[model samples]
Target: MTEPLQHADHLLRAEGLECERDGRTLFSDLSFSIVPGTLTRVEGPNGSGKTTLLRILAGLNDNWSGQVYWCGQPRQKHWDLVRRNVLYLGHRPGIKMLLTPLENLQALVAGRQQVPGRVLGQALEQVGIGPWSHVPCGQLSAGQKRRVALARLLFADEPVWLLDEAFTALDVDAVAAVERLLEDRVRQGGAVVMTTHHEPAMQGMRRIRLGGAGEQGPVTRAVGEVD
Candidate 1:
């Protein structure tokens, strides 16, 4: 894990964004800015392209037409900066089922930074899955697997986060824990953008709906055209 720059003001801006699939328009001319110390929730009905929006911001999807700026520069121009600072946790747990939580976390963070085994253990405990740290993830419950994947957040110091359905499969206590983690991150000047149907109980959060008024173009229109 590359240590992200601390106390840095981060910004992610999308302008004139539009997307289409199977001859249907999902959203168009959607623009928003994610500022430091704030959590922006992306919400909309199903097929509204919430996941696509996150992917576009994370530089994982190029099927859409828009301009994304990281900090004050185009994201494409500072790919290195975005890559090092952004942490994306998708809907599915990315851990290997065959590996134990300890091994999975270690493998995930190995290339980015050198984290001690002790730290990993502590993180697992924080997520309430410490007792199963040695068990193979395949045998873990859905919620447990989710917790195992979430443990990575404890060690991740990234300045920007993009999460998709992070609260799924989590119980009430686990939900509160995850919310606290996001709150702490925002308080520390990190920014977060996530998509979820459940309302986040945290303060100082903003909302952006993908299929809201003036956000989607007619399906007959061109996909990438600005106007």
Candidate 2:
């Protein structure tokens, strides 16, 4: 049996995680814990199951067998609660090209936290896309579209963020803005788990590399201490 976590303050925990694709084992026996007010980065070479792990953590791909604990309890038992507090941003923009930036945000907002149009507009402005708020997402450049997708992070009230290659098309300024936003989230007692191949630009972030022949190891404080 896996040892019970010593730090009960963990916001996210995964134990004995296993994932398979096309009848081939991708990764197994993974475990990890994320504490509030911290940033955890998942790093590895290509085809290392970085995105797969993020999906499992976000409760999207449920084909795996393992246990996930949220806020010190079984995630399966409180899936709804976990869902409310977690935001998963994948490589795809996941935005509707036909909708304006504001409309896209309004459509994706969930739970009781409805961001007012003014606030959503402000978030877009912060991302340096205020001028394009009324423009259709399909008309925007790749980087602009990416920024629009990232704007969700600013307005969403979730306590945990899972991002896969979030910095893909961002410029230097946009990258700095994202780093600041994530920093603010951690300072507010929120937790973040992200997958990135490039060296993280954010300070005080913990990094863990994935990908191997055997079962992947659990995320530990040692991995989380990569500053």
Candidate 3:
């Protein structure tokens, strides 16, 4: 007898979500579903609420109205569970300038399972900054700093990845490395959602655009038929 294939779980669902700041609507009536084994890109022009949507997905912006579901349940009903399953990386490379790249990785992964030095070295090599692993991040180039921040993704074991402009300051090789990492995650039944001004390099990914006078509502450009 042959074993049955396991279907990827729906990691996130947003329905009728509305966000506002100081009485100005950022986005409203936004709806989408993200499943494991896929990458969903949120693309739009400047001031179009891409970051706002990412925040809502990450549960960092709780003021929004409507529902966000995780694993088919309301996220609010199980905040801890949702948070544990998701990893959000913002536009800023959240690294301590004083710390070496290896030290920063050590601090971030200290409490979790031990991060092997070989794995850390491999991740740094993937981003083409392996040679500078011992250098303080403040002394590195802007692109190198960005790569150091991105190294956290490799150590994070979450199922969902939320990145805002992840490619910012990345060189060509770094961009390719990031894309490969994302593709590998999807292949292993992980989900990804990100905001980017430029289209991502990954193929078969979904794209959503936010529009309207106040960034109200989203229009799907290209997506998998079911999502």
Tens digit of per-residue lDDT, candidate 1, span 43-124: 7777778898888888988899988898778899889878877888888757999999999999988876689999999999
Per-residue lDDT tens digits for candidate 2, residues 1-227, read 33332434888888878787777666677777888778988877677688998898888898899898987799889887888878899998579999998888778774437778888889999888899999899998989989988988887777789999999988888887888888888787778898876676777887766665445543222265656
* Candidate 3 segments whose C-alpha is farther than 4 A from its true place: 1-8, 111-113, 212-227
Question: lDDT score, residue 159, model 3?
Answer: 77
The TM-score values for the models, in the order shown, are: 0.88, 0.88, 0.87
Rank by lDDT, highest first: 1, 2, 3
**Worst lDDT window (10 residues) for model 1?**
218-227
Go through the candidates in order and give each one's C-alpha lDDT: 0.82, 0.80, 0.78
> Model 1 TM-score?
0.88
Give the 10-residue window scoring lowest on summed lDDT in candidate 3: 1-10
Which of 1 and 3 is ahead in lDDT? 1
State which candidate, 2 or 3, has the greater TM-score.
2
